[model samples]
Target chain A: MIDMFRRRFISVMVILLLIISGCNNRQETSSTNEAGDQVITIRAQTFGDEQTRIQNLEEAAKELNEQLKAENKKIQVKLETSSFDGSWEEYRRQFILAFKSKNEPDIFLTGHEDIAWLAKGDYILPLDELKDSEAYRDVYPTLWESVTWNGHIWGALQDTEARPIFYRKDVLKQLGWTDEEIESLPEKVKNGEFTVDDMTRVAKEAIDQGLVQWGILHRPVNGPEFHMIAKNFGAQLYDPKEDKLVFDKEAILESLRYFESLTQKEKVTPESMTSMEWKNVHQMMIDGKALFWYGGIWNIFNYMDQGAEFDYLMENFGFTLVPATEKGGTPMTLSHPIVHTVSSQTVHPDLVIRLLELVAKPEYQAKHSVETFHLPIHERGSEVEQFKNDEFLSQITYMLDYTTFLPNHADFNKYGDAYFNAIQSVEIGKKTPEEALKDMEVQIQNDLGDTIIIK
Target chain B: MKKWVLPYLMLTPFLLLVLLFFVTPVVITTIMAFTNMDYSMEWNFIGLQNFEKIVSDPNFSQIVFNTFIYVGFTLLINVFFALLLALLSSYYIPFEQSGLFFRALWMLPRITPPVVYVLLWLWIFDASEYGLLNTLTSFFFSNDPIAWLIDHPMTAIILVNGMVGASFGMIIFSSAIQSIPRDLFKAAQVDGASEWSVFKDIILPSIKWPIMFVTVWQLLSLLTSYEYILLLTDGGPVFESEVWPLYSYHKAFKNLEFGYGSALSLILVIIAILLTGVLLKLFKFNRMIQSSRIE
Candidate 1:
C-alpha cells in the first residue's frame, strides 16, 4: 500500500509541475520563413478609445509590404498593438512601465508633451540623423517644431488637431443677430475685432435673454486648451535658450482672472464645469443647450456619434480660434499633436523608420484625419480628397495658422498641472484669482525648483 | 533528522509563497524608498531627500486631514450599519429566513466588479438632468439638476466606499452573533428583558471580537484603498478628495516620481502599523484573546 501511494504521489507531483510550467509557454513571436531572406517584426502601439490610428498604422505596413514585394525585398514587417481606453493617464503609466522593463514596442505613438520626458530618459531614439527625403519635406515646417528637442528630431508628427470654440448660430440669431452678422462672427474673432471680453458679453446677453439654458461650456478637465488662453494673455511656458520651463506670473494671473470671471463674476460658465465628466460635456453640446462650447475639432465627430446630425451642426454651429484676450490682441489656438517615436531598444530601427515614413505620408495621414477627425500632419494631406471634401476640416484649417502647441519640456507638465489646479480652484469659487496665482507661484517654485525661471 | 526534514518539506510550498508574494516585495519597496528611481528606472541612491521633501511639503497636512476624514467616517458608517444589519437579520427577523436574502443582497455591491459599481455610481450622480438621481429629483421636487459629485465629493466617496465595505463587517458580525449560545438570550427574555437590553447585555458582549476585527480590518483597508475614489473623484476638483494612497499613486505613476512615492508608501506602512498597535490597545486585545468564561 505504501509503495503504491508513493508512486501515485510522484505522478501527481510531475503532472502539477507540468501544468505550472505550461502556463508560461503561451506563445512566441511569430516570424515568417524564407530560404535565406531577412524578416523583421516591427511592433507598434498607441492608445485611444478609437482604433483609427491603429488601422492607419496597419495600412501603412501593408503599403510598405507591397513596395517591398515589387522590389523583391525579403524584409517583412509585422505589427502588434494594444489600444487603450479613454484614460490617457493610465495609458501613459502603462507606457512608462513598459519602457522601464525594456518591453516597449519598436515604434509607439504619444503626444508631443511626452517628447521631453521620453528624450531626456533616453527611452526613444533620436531621428535627427535619418536621411531627409522629399516625403519628409512634404510635412508642414511648423510641425517640425513639435518633434524637435535639444537639436534632435525625436519623433515624426503622426497627427495634429486644433482646439477651437464652437458656437450655435441659431442662438446668436435668437439673440437678435442677423444672418450677415452671424456670418461675420468668425472673421471678426479671427481679426481680433471681437475679443474674449466681447465673446463673454455676447454669451451673457444670450443667457439673460433666455436664448439658451447655459451661455457657454468648456472642457471639463485639464488639457492644452488653457495653454492657448495663457499664450493669448502673453504667457510663454518654455524658455528655449535656457532649456527650462517658464512661469510668467502676470500672464498666468491674467488668464486665471479671465476664467474666474467667466465662472464667478460673468457667470457665463458653470462653476462646477471642471468636475464634469467628458460624456456630460459632449451630451450637453449635442443637445444644443449652450450658446457656445469650448472644444476640440475631434469633439465634432464625438457629438455626431452621440446622435447630433451633421446637417444640423452645419446649419447651426460655427467654429473659430478662441478670441484674443482683448481687442486687437492676436488670436491663437492650441494644438497637441500625437507623434510616432521609435524606441531606442528596437532591433530594427531602420524598418521602424520606414514604417513611420509610410504612416506619415499625406494620403494615409488624410485617411487618418477623415476617420479620426484629427487634422492632417502634412501640407499635402489638406489637398487630399478625403480631407478637402470635409467642409468642417476646410473651415477649421485656418486655426492651424494661429496654432501654438504645449511646451515640450519634461517639467512643463509640472507647471501646467499647477496652472490647471489654480484654474479649477478659481472656477469652483474656492479661491480668488490673486490667491490662486500666489498658490500657483509657490507650487511651481516648489515642484520645478531651479528648473523654472519665474518672471 | 528524517522527522525534521519531512516537516520542513511539507512547509516548503507555503514558505516559497510567503517569500515570493510578501517578503520579496517588501524588501524591494524598502530599498526603493531610498533611491531616486523614476521613468528612466535608474536607481540612484538619494538617501532621505524624498522623505524630507514630503515632511516639509505644504500639502502634507491636507493629505493627512483627507486621509483621517475618509477613514474615520467610512469606518463609522461601515461599523454602525454592519452591526445594525447583523442584529436585525440574525435575531430580530430570523423567522422569515429573510436574513440570508438581505445579506446576499448587501453583498451584491461587494461582489459586483468595482469598475461597474463605480460606473453605476457615476451615472446615478451624473450632474446632468439625464442622471438617475437628477431625473427623480426634477420630477418630484421641481429643482434644477444638482452636481452631486462636485458638490459633495467627500460625502459621495465615503458613502460609496462605506456601502461596499459594510457587507464585509456584516458577514463577520452576523456569524459571530449566531455563534453566541442561545441559552443566554432565552434567559434574558424570560426575565422580562427588552430586545435592546438583551442585545446590549448578551449579544454585544459575545460579538466584541468580531467588532474589533471588523474595525481594525476596515480601518487598515480604508487607509490603503483608493481605487473607488480614484475611479470616482480621481482626487480632483482641486484635490478635495485626495487620500494618502491616491496621492502616492499620482506621485509615483502620474508624476513619475517613484522614489518620493515609495517614501510616501513607506510612511503609510509606518502609520498603519502604529494605528494597528493603538487599535489593539483600545480593544484590549490581550484580554479579548482569552476565553471569557469556563465551559
Candidate 2:
C-alpha cells in the first residue's frame, strides 16, 4: 500500500512540472513576436479637425495596404496629430511644445516654407539616403526638387496642388464664346493677349448680362494667399539677395489701388468681400453666387466628391494663373506640397520607412490619386489611365506648369499675419495703399528681428 | 473627541481633494514659473527672471492696462445695465409673467456656449460693409466698411461681453429685491413715501449685498476672461484686447515661453486673491450673511 501511494505521488509531480514548462514555452513565443511586430508611430502638428487631410491620409493608407499586402508584408502605422484649428500663431506654439517632447514623431508633414529653417534641427534625419533609392527616383521630379535643402534631399512629398482660377462657362456661352474659344483661352493668357484688365472687361459683360452677382471672388483673408496676390503685382515681401525685407512700395500700392477698384469702381466683387472669410469663397463659387473662384486642386476634388456631376461645370470652368505685369507675362500660382517624413527619434524607424516606401509605390500613388481625386506626385502616377481619361483633372493638369513658392522661412508665420492685416487695411479703406505697404514692411522687419533674412 | 472626529471626517475629503488637484498643481506651476525648461518639461530652475522680464516689457504695461480696462469698464457697464434690467423686471414692468419671462430671455446669452456666443457676436460685428450692423449703418449713413475689431477694439469687446454681464446682476438683483419684506413698503406707503423713496431707503439697503456681490464677481470674471477676445481679435492690430489670461496664453503658446506663462498665471492668482479679500472685507459678506440668517 505504501509503495503504491508513493508511485502515484511521483506521477502527479511529473504532470505539474510538464504543465509549468508548457506555460514557459508559450510566453517565449509571444515575447519574440512582439519584438518583431514592425509597427511605427508618426506624429505631426497640423489642424487636426480638417476633415479633408484626414480623409486623404486614410485613402493613402488604403492604397498603401493594397501594395503591402501584394508583397506579403504588412506595416502597422499609428498617426498622432495635433490641430491648432485656426490660429497659425497658436499652431507654432503647440509645435514648439511637442517638438520639445522626450520622443519625437517618426514622420511629419510641413509646408515648403517650414523646410528651410526647422529642418536644420539635428533631430530630423536627412532623407538623402532614402531619396537616392530607386523608389524615390521614380517619383515626381518637381515634388522632389522643391523639398531638397542646400542640394540635399530633406523630405518626401505627398504632392503639391496649385491654385487655379475657376470661371463659369455658362456665362461664357451666353456671351457667345464658342467651346473652342474657351479651350484656346490658355493660349490667350500665355500669348500676352489676356490681362486682368481684359478679365475685368469680360467680367463686366457677364455681370451686365446678369450672369452672377459678382465678377470675381478670392479669399482675401489674413493668410499668405493675400501675400501671393500682392507679390503678383511686384510686391516681394523679402529680398533673398540682401536677406532682408525689400518693400516694393510702388508695386504694392499699384496692386492695392487696382484691388480697391474691383469693389469701389468696377463692382466686380461685392463690397462685403473686404471681410469675406476664406471658407466662404469656396462655398460661394459652388452656390453660383460668384462668377469665378480662385482655389487649389483640392477644391476640384471636393466638388467631384460631393457627387456634383462635373461634366457641365468642367466644360464651363477654365484655369488661369494669376496675371503678371506683362500681357503675356508668365502667370504664377503657388504649389504648396504636403510632405510625409520618417522620424529620426522613432524606436522603429525601419518599420516606418518600410511603410512609407510601400505607400510610395507607383501603383499605390496612382490608386490614391484616383481615390482622393488629387493630382499625383509620381510621374507615372500622374499619367495613370484614370487621370488621362478625366477631363476636369486634365484642365487642372495644364495649370501645374505655372506653380511657384512662397518664403520657406520658419518665421514666415509672424510676418505673414502682419502682411495679411496690411492687405485687410487697404481693402477696408482704413489705410491708403501706400500707408498699408509701409506698415507691412515695418511689421515684417519687426518680426524678423535678427534672423537670417531670405531674399 | 466626538466633535473633533465628525469635523475631521467631514473636512478630510474636501481638504485632500483641494490639496491634490489644486494646491499641488499651483506649487508645481510656481516652481515651473522660475525655470527656462523648453523641451518636454525638462525644467532647470532659473529663479525670478521670468517675472522680471514680464515687468520690464512694454507689452506688460499695455496688458495691465487692458486687464483693468476690461474689468473696471465691464463692471460699471454690466452693473448699470443689470440694475436697469432688474428694475424693469420688478412689478414696475407690464409683462404678463411679471419679468421672469424677460429675465429668462436675458439668461439665453449667458447659457449659450462661450464659443458660439462669441461667434454670433462676430457675425454681428462682421467687418464687411454688408454685415448686419454695417448694412444698417450704410443704409442710414456711410457706405464704407468699419474695421469694427480694430477701431473700437475695447468697446466692441465690452459690448459683446455685456451680453454676459447683464444677466448676472439681473438674476442676483431680482432675487435680492424680491427678498425685502413687504412690511417695510407698507410702512413707507402709510408715511406717504413715493415709489422712488421706498426704493431709495428700504429696497436699496436690502439689495446692497447683491450689488456688491455682482460687482465683485463680474470684476473677477472680466479680469480673467480670455475666450471672447481670443476668438474675435486675438489681441491685435496690436495687443489691444489683451487681458491677463490672454497675455499668459500668448506667452506660453506663441512665444514658446512656458515659464513666462506660468509666472504670469501666478501673478494673476495673487491679484485675484487680493481682489477677493478686499471685496469680502468691503461688503462685510460673512458677517452680514450670518446676521441676516439669524434674523
Candidate 3:
C-alpha cells in the first residue's frame, strides 16, 4: 500500500511538472484592465536623442492640450514619452509590446518603409479612406502609395531621408580638382565615368599622399546604409510585382566585388571597415581620420552638437548626393518616410486626426522640422527659411530632389536583411558573391515564401 | 490530516511562484510559438508551428553555434582562472592578510556598472585602425592594431567575463579550503609526500566538492551573462558573439517576436540545466566531505 502511494505521488508530481511547464508560455497573457471610458486617448511615440525626445514630447503635449481646451471636449488626451531612447530596435519592440496591452498608445511613428507590414498586421490603421480628402497627396503621385498595404494606405509622412557624401575639400583642392571639376563630379558619377573604381583611386591617392587613411567609409555594417548605396548602383532588391526577393545577383555581385576590392585589391579602405558602424564613420570624419563620409542629413546637427563649428568644418567640407549608376539616371537617394500613424484602438481618433492635420500644416511642419534638425519632405523641406538659407541644408535639399524609398512591403524588412547579410558575407570574404547570392535566393524562397520573387 | 496540511502549506509559495514566473509563461509561449505573436496588436496562436519556424530560421544554426562558443569559452576560462586564484590565495604568505583587500579590489571590475565597463572595453577593443591597442602597437611595437571584439569576439568577451568571475571562485575555494583539517596536510607531509602528491591526494580531494559546486554555479551564470557582449557588440558584425541569452533578448525585443523569443529562452534554460547536471556528474563529488570516510 505504501509503495503504491509513493509511486502515485511521484507520477502525479511529474504530470504536474509537465502541465505547469506547458502553462509557462506567453499565449496565456490576458488583457491588463477591463475596457473603460470610450474617450479616445490617442497615444503616439517617437524616438530621438535624449534631449530631443523630451523636447518633442513636451512640445507635442503642449499642442495637444491647447487643441483639447479649444474644442471644449471631455475626452482626455495623454502622450507618454521618454528621453531614455534606447536602440531603435528596442524602442520599436517596446512600442509593439505596448500595443498588446489594452492601454496601448493609439498612434505611433513607423520610420521604416515597412509601415505597410504594421498595417497589414493590423497594428497600424489604414489611412486610404482618408486619402480622398487629404490635401497632402499633391506632394507626389506615389507618396501615399508607398505606405499603402493590401490596397489600403497606412502611414503618413512626418519626415523623409536624404543622404549626401560629405567630402574633404582640402584634399580635393590639393588634388587640383577645380570648381569645374567639383560641379561636374555628380554628373560624371551618374555617367559611369566615375565608378567605384574612380572612388577607390581617390581613396588610394589620399592614403598615399598621407592626406587621410580612410577615404570613403559609410556605415560599413549598417544594413540600411548599404541598401541605400545598393539601390543606387542599380541593384534591384525585390520584384514587388512578383512578390519575390530578387537580388540582381550580378549587380549586387558587382557591387560587393567592388566593395571588397576597396579592402582587398585597392587596399584603400581598412580591414576594420567592417567593424566601424555609421556613427563611428561620421565621428572619424569629424576627428579628421577620414576624408569622406556618406550619411543622412542629420549628421549636420550631430557634428554641431559635438562642438564642431559649422563654418570651420564647411571651409574644407562640401557634399554631393551619392550618384546613381554610370547609367545617366537620377542618383537614388534611399529614404523611408517617418509617418505619424493613428491607432485602431484609439478612443479619440478624430482628435488624433485633427492633431496630425495640424502638424501636417506647412508652418507647423516647418517649425518642427527646424527643431528636429531633419529634412522634412513635405512643403516643410523647402519652405523652412532656416533650411533654405543654410548652406549645408541647401546642399541637402538639392540631394532630396531625386530620392527613393526602401521597399515598403510587409516582408521587406526580412528581405532587406537577407540581401544585406548576403552582401556582407561576400564583402567580408566569408562567402564568394556568387555563392552568397545563390544561398540567399534559396533561403529567401524558403523563409519569405511568395513574399519576394527569387530571381 | 496534520501531516498533509503542513506539507501543502509549505509547498504553496514555491509552487505559486513557479506557476507565476515560470510555468505559466512557458506554457503560454509554447502555445504562442505555433501562432504568430507579433505583438498584442496582432496575436494568433498556431500549434508546433513556432518550433518548426524557429528551428528552420536561417539564423537558428549560426546563433546556436555562436551561443555555445561564447558560453563554453567563458565558463571554461572563468572556472580555470578561478581555481588557480583560489589555490594560490590559500597560501599563508607574509602580509597575506592583504589578499582579502586584493580580492575585494579584484571584484571591483565586476561591481562596476556593466554599461561603464562596456564603454571602457569600447576604447580598449576599438576596431578603429588607431584605437587603443592599435595605437599602442603602432607607437611601441610597430604592428597594426588588432580589432579586438569584431574579429575575435569570443576571446575578447571570455577574457572580460573570466577576469570578473575570478574573485568569486577564489572566495568560495578559500573558505572551503580553510574549513579542512590542517592535520591532513601535515600527515601527508610527514609521510615524505612530494608537493604535487600532497596537492593531488590531500588538497585536491578536500576541495573536490567545493570545486564541483563552483563549476556548476559558474556554468549557470556564464551562460546567461550577455552584458559585456550586449554593450560591446550588440550581436552585430553578423552576430559573432551572440549567446543564447542575447539571441533570446534580440528576438523578443529587437525583432518583436515574443513567442519565438520565449521558445529560444526555454532552450537556453534546458541547456543551462543540462550543463549543470553534467558538471555535477563529471566531478563524482556528490557533496562536501562528511568527516572524511576515506577507505
lDDT of each model, Cα atoms only? 0.84, 0.67, 0.66
Best by TM-score: 1
Worst 10 residues of 1 chain A by lDDT: A22-31
Kept native contacts, as fractions per model, are: 0.42, 0.17, 0.31
Question: How far does residue A388 in candidate 3 sit from its true spot (Å)?
Answer: 2.4
Residues A1-455 of candidate 1: C-alpha lDDT, one tens digit per residue: 44565576577678868986765452233466674445566778887865878887899899888887778887666778667676766677777777655667777788888888899888899997543755677676777788888888999888899988899998898889999999898899888898889889999998898777777888787778888888989998898778899889899889999999899998988887876778878887777678888789998788888888889888988887889887887888888889888888787787788888877778887888888888887788999998999988888887888888888888776777788889999988889999999988877777777999889
Candidate 1 pairs with clashing backbones: none
Report how far off residue A264 is in candidate 3 (Å).
Answer: 1.8
After superposition of all CA atoms, the RMSD between model 2 and the true structure is: 9.3
| Error at A129, model 1, angstroms | 4.6
Ranking by DockQ: 1, 3, 2
Error of 1 at A161 (Å): 0.7
TM-score of chain A of each: 0.91, 0.78, 0.81
Candidate 1 lDDT tens digits, B1-295: 4456567656766886798799897788888899988767789998998888888766788889989999999999899999988888788885646989988899999999999999999889887777789899999998887878778999999999999999999999899888888888788878999988888888888888888899999999999889999989888767889999999998887788788888899899889999999999999999888868312
DockQ of each: 0.44, 0.17, 0.26
User: In DockQ, how does model 3 score against the reference complex?
Assistant: 0.26
